[model samples]
Target chain A: MRKLSKVITIFVMVFLSVALSFAQGSGDKLGDQSKLIKTLNKPLTFVFIPKVIHPWYDVVKEGALAAAEEFKKMGITVNIKFDAPTNADISEQMKKIEANISARPDGLAIAALDPATNTRLINDAIKAKLNVITFDTDAPNSNRPLYVGHSKDFQDGYDLGEYLAKLINYKGKVGILSGSLTAPNHVGRVKGFKEAIAKYPGISIVFDRPDNDDLQKAVELTENALQANSDLVGIFGCNASNPIGAARAVKAAGKTGKVHIVGMDDLPETLQLIKEGVIDATKAQRQWEIGYWAVKYLVAMNQNHTIPAVHETGSRLITKNDL
Target chain B: MKKFIKTKEMSMFIALAILCLIMTVSTSTFMTPYNIGIIARQISFIAIVAIGQTIVLLTGGIDLSVGSIAGLSGILCSLLMTKMHVDTLSIIFISLVLGIILGCVNGILIGRLKLNAFIVTLAMGEIYGGLILVITRGYPILDLPESFAFLGQGMIGLVPVPVIFMLVITVVIAYILENTPFGRNIYAVGGNSVAAKLAGIKVENVTLYVYMLSGMFASFSGLLLTSRMNAGQPTIGSSWVMPSVTAAIIGGTSLSGGEGTIIGTIIGAAFMGVLANGIVLLNISSYWERVITGAVVIIAVVIDLLRKIRSQKE
Candidate 1:
């Protein structure tokens, strides 16, 4: 009985330590640097809320922090607070925004999960006199001053579609695996892809499915797609997870080079897969630029400096040769 | 033969057969060996997890932590291989042992402490799920060894390696449930815990062992998926918890306990696999796929319930 208690105690301690470590948000202090010019004396705090807690947003946070470091060199104290919901939930995100608003930060930048609902919240934040901006995902109808992120999701998808069509010589069946069916970005990409491929007389889309942003679901759906269309020659992944998932299925089916794959985002797994030749190319979004510019623009807004209504941090297509 | 035909497993098997028949007729590719192999491998992961869930359900307990354990185990195994440079065999052994230990924790909390199984496992599930995100930080562990891929992608005489593992697990577990005293004790405890204790059964020990087995099975499935994907994905098993329970329930496992079979769970999983595969093969719209799948599950359970009513009356 005593030994059992000891084992239980150890387990509980380990769990508590791990949980406590992860409780804090991904915010780090900037190093000290001699001031080039004493422009601002007071420390400014800004909060960035993304759709969910994902590695993609983590990269964005890195950019926001990098901007903070730049301001430190200018003798400006910029404190960045990064917070996001654990799951991609609208209500949870709304609650975070509300809480941050009440906290009265100098600025708030959000990646809208639902444009309709977030537009209302963004308006409310503006009414509260807080400088507001948007990033990654934009709520155009909102009162926010500027949007800093990639705005050409459809064009990027079209480019990928054209590339895949050419790779397959414009005469083979293709499939598309996207993230959520409702996400505007994913939907736009899918729409653009179908339009681009429709120009090819012989190329036809045989299967289209949503993996709901799950890697395993993406794998299963791709496997099923491959089985359903035995002669499928190309696949388009409309998000970060799906392309890697699709590549895994293609490799397992022993059709690595036989089937061409193009996808969105430059997740580490997706890049490795591209290097391995299992995947042909991916659309690399400028996540760091979006973060850096979001903070920069938010500071300008606070200082009453005019900023552009849209700051497009564009994306580029990455192939094996690019890597 | 009449008695066998009247069984719940028989009803489920019929449903599965009907699904397969519809797919085979609707799509020319559905019945081919290639498609069959894909379906078999797809179902094997869920089928393995459902086996352990079936045991826990037989004890009138639910194991919500199965999915989280699977995800964490896969991540840990990948980390060990990539960061620690551990050998594949030792890593597999270490992961299985870790799974057992994790399950044992749940068992002790619920079995020894006499806590509510639902609440205990649910909390444990959240803890394990959070641990995965913390460890991986929402990134997949990539660059697994090429040799490890055999566990997920290899074929032996037209059968997937994971499928073989699933079959072996099913047979061993089936034998234990039917032919062992411990297995019988599990049913008794679920049927009536006080009565089981009065009959000199160590109910706590049975509960502990069942949860341990559940953890081990979930971990094994996680390992197989990691090998198959050739990367340790943090989101590997997030979508599995609901399916694990659904598969057991569809296979005719009673929610109240002590009235399910291993064969029923396998057929249940296969039914779901065929349903998903058929939707794709028949070119069903993506928007309507979930609605159709949900409707099919309801119809299957209703048919099983009606069959049970008829058998009871007769």
Candidate 2:
């Protein structure tokens, strides 16, 4: 019994140390930088909220905590509190923002899911004297001082469209799989893709299916697109799941090499597909930079520094060779 | 034949026909063999799960955990294959067994313990979601074997394998609900549990089996999806709970219990599938798809109610 108690005590000690390390790992310190700025004389608390709890936002949270560490180094005890809804929900985001407002943090950074529905709440956050800044899907019309995110969604789609057209030799029909139409970024990408397709008159969009960000629906849409358009040469997916879904359908039909696929976002499956030659290419967004810079900008603003109205974190074209 | 005409399934059939006619007129591609194949394949997953849900509903119980069960089972199957080197067939078998065990958890709570079905399943769904997150950490499992894809993406002659699975499950369920003594017991249990108990029927067993069956079907559907995507996705089946209930409800399955047909549910699934296809084919703004679908479901239910009232008056 004494030996068992000693073993239990050792186990509890090891468990506590492991848990403590995990807690500290989340509070990443900012890496070496070329420029130096004054640290805050007093401790300031900041809240960072994302649209949802996802792997993508996990990177964003890393950037925010890193920024907090940077502030801490400057003699400011920057307390960073990160909170978000369990799912990608707009109303839940609003409630979190409201609670943050009640807490009266020194500043707040948010990535809005529904900009229109959130515009009033954002304005209210500003009305409450909280330094509110938007990242990722921005609330442009809101009273927020700066919007730090990717370049125009249209340009991203246009580039993919042009690349795909050239790959197909400006011929045959192509299908476009998109996310929810209500999403501004997805709509912009579709418009840009259309504009690019218009330049290649030989290539026509046979069908466009909205999967509502559901991967299963994305698979079904791709199958239907292939079935409905027998002459299809390629597909362009506007979201992470769209390309993976399209690739599955293409592979299932034994048309992998023949049917080229281009998609947005560098999801793990998308990267795997690219490595396997199932997906021709994907446009990799600087999601890490979006988060990293958003927090940096928020910190500067908190310190009475003026920032740009729009910060464009550019995208990269990733192919098989790049992988 | 005359009695068949008066049935709710006939009215739903007429609605589906009218919807198809409108789609055909609006889009030249709507009636193509390819498009029909897509609709059938797309309806298979929801339809299969709904068949299980319909069984539970016939016993006056709701299974909100169907979607979560699918997600959890798929993730677990994917993990076993990727980490443990489990063979394809055995992985699927183990996943289905896991689903049955999970369902039995609910069965024990709702059936044996006599807890509220809604609350029990809702809480269980949360537990399932948490377990999936713990296992997957929000990342997809991509090392699916080649042989596994056949179950989801393969075709026999002209029909997709998933569609075949859907049809087989539907036929078996329809037989069980219509011809078997256990089928009558289900109706009896749902219609009146006290009377069913008085009539020498094992009410608790029927309840437990239906929930178990719901879990099994959900797990099977998840495996099909894992095959289709060629990966095990953490987010698989997140949008399924509503559609499972919707398909059964639209198929003329009474939520209050004791009235529904698998054929009606199949037609209902087809109706929804076609409506979505029509929106895409006609080039209507995709934003209107959800609005239109919601309106159609309401209109379909209202028309059915009106038909019942008219028949009573006659």
Candidate 3:
């Protein structure tokens, strides 16, 4: 009986090790796909669709326009058509995507609003022989060639959380002002923050609220949160507006340096706050990089060059010192 | 005393007191001096805007363009200050004048041309909102002068400067609504426009003035908010329109016309502020806050309706 049990334990250990190795191998394969070299000297047009006409997407446009300029310098005409819906409505986004698909651009980049609907639209575009890639917000289930943007929103939040935990000495009450509860990116950030803070046993989250991406609403919510938890030591602003809002509230309550603020995005107001020492830090997503790479990768894919499945334009943690 | 107790403003006051009582019981921080100050400063902006909304409601018209006017005025003022090197006082004056001009355009269309108030203002709102986007291109104008911050972030003996402005504006507007012949004309015009016209009130002029006042109030709030934020944000007044209307309605201002007070509107604004503050103090889920706020607005309106029906029967 002892000999049989030993054989079974050895077999089980071997199976588990093999499975782990296979998982790692697959991860590497997805991340490190070798680029297939191709050169195509021709004029091309690409359509880029974002979720909404926001300032954030404006930065993305800048990056894309820069890439187009770069191609122009190389004597290749890369016409980038940047179209976006005025509102973040799923149906409107779908309509825009359908219109673009029918137009049949050489390459298409989309920030998916609704994953299921967008996946179907992306598949239709694929059927039309248009090379499609996702940016900013991805429709992973679709037949898109690649995703190029800040893919790790969770990591952005987790890193900020860890930085904030360290700032507060890993102990005290904290508050999270998540922008838009329904947004997948905001939700992922909030989850990451909660998970990161949970690792520190002494840290407790006393307040969690959604500001709906409104600056004034964020200010009101943060003020209320500060009032509710007088002993609160830190705040995590899960979007651009929230950190500036939190900084204002902390300044108003005369708790400026007493409460640490770690937030996402480096809007001008946010950077100003950081410079003034009102905000501790912020994680600015590489928006320009997302736009730059989406254009480059789309051009490459159109030329039949193989690129990595995901291109994560990482974020930068901006502190007062960094400014 | 009996007559006071029967007033809509009085009822709103009582409701507000009960809400405060509940909040105080539920949380130690609700009644704190610090929280009160915060609530006061926060409510002052909407309350000021609601004052004009109350007047517009009294005149049987709505100004959906107030929010857009606010946003545009703020952007214009910030541009003047930062780009053109305009002085602080001149910046304020210019923005307010610009607001009046915007309001005048709406008035000329709705009052003189006799267009539908809802459609005219809604379209005007879209135009103004679009202009804000076009002007700023989704960027916030920053680096406002330091001296200008006092209007928003300053305090006098623990009362925020904005609160003082709110109270002063409330008193003046309340007096105008309750005492003067112009005030009587507003009530008369709102009660019955044909009757008011026969009674020798220039209905168009009154309409024009009310909208102008609404625009001025909105611009004032925009200025204060920009000062507070230390930047001119394009998204500043996008959320103000619904709340301005909600505050007036909650204060027992009749939507049809001729039935609300500035004091009542103030109380309505305060009620909203307290409810929002209390939600956080009570640690309620953020998702439930909107649900509660909507229910409260409905309840307040229903109470007003029930009172009207009871009085009619009596």
Pick by lDDT: 1 or 3, better one: 1
Per residue, candidate 1 scores C-alpha lDDT tens digits across A197-276 of 99999999999887878899999999999889889999999988899999999999999999999998898888899999
Worst 10 residues of 3 chain B by lDDT: B280-289
lDDT of 2 by residue, A1-323 (tens): 99999999999999999999987766544553323444456677667777766676666667777766776677667666566655564433544565556556677888877665466668878997889988887878889998888858999899999999999999899988977654567878888888999998799889887787778999998888888878789999998778899999999998988999998988888899999999999888888787678778777876777689999888899999897
The TM-score that candidate 1 achieves is 0.53
Task: Report, for every candidate in turn, its global Cα lDDT versus the true structure.
Answer: 0.85, 0.81, 0.84
Q: What's model 1's overall lDDT?
A: 0.85
What is candidate 1's lDDT per residue for B1-314, written digit by digit as tens? 99778788898898789878887777676787766876788789889999999999999999999989999999999998999898878877987898899899999998999999999999999999889978975556877888887887789999999999999999999999989998899889888989999999999999999999999999989898778766787766666777788888888888888888999999989988777666545544334545776776687679778877887898
- Give the alpha carbon lDDT tens digit for every residue of A28-79 in model 3: 7675535344566678988888887678877888899999899888877888
Candidate 3: share of reference interface contacts reproduced: 0.00
Q: Candidate 2: lDDT over CA atoms?
A: 0.81
In model 3, how large is the Cα lDDT of residue A228? 86
> Candidate 1 — which residues are off by over 4 angstroms?
A1-323
- Model 1: which residue pairs collide? none
Q: DockQ score for model 1, please?
A: 0.02
Look at candidate 1 and tell me the lDDT of residue A165. 94
- List iRMS for all predictions: 18.9, 17.9, 19.0
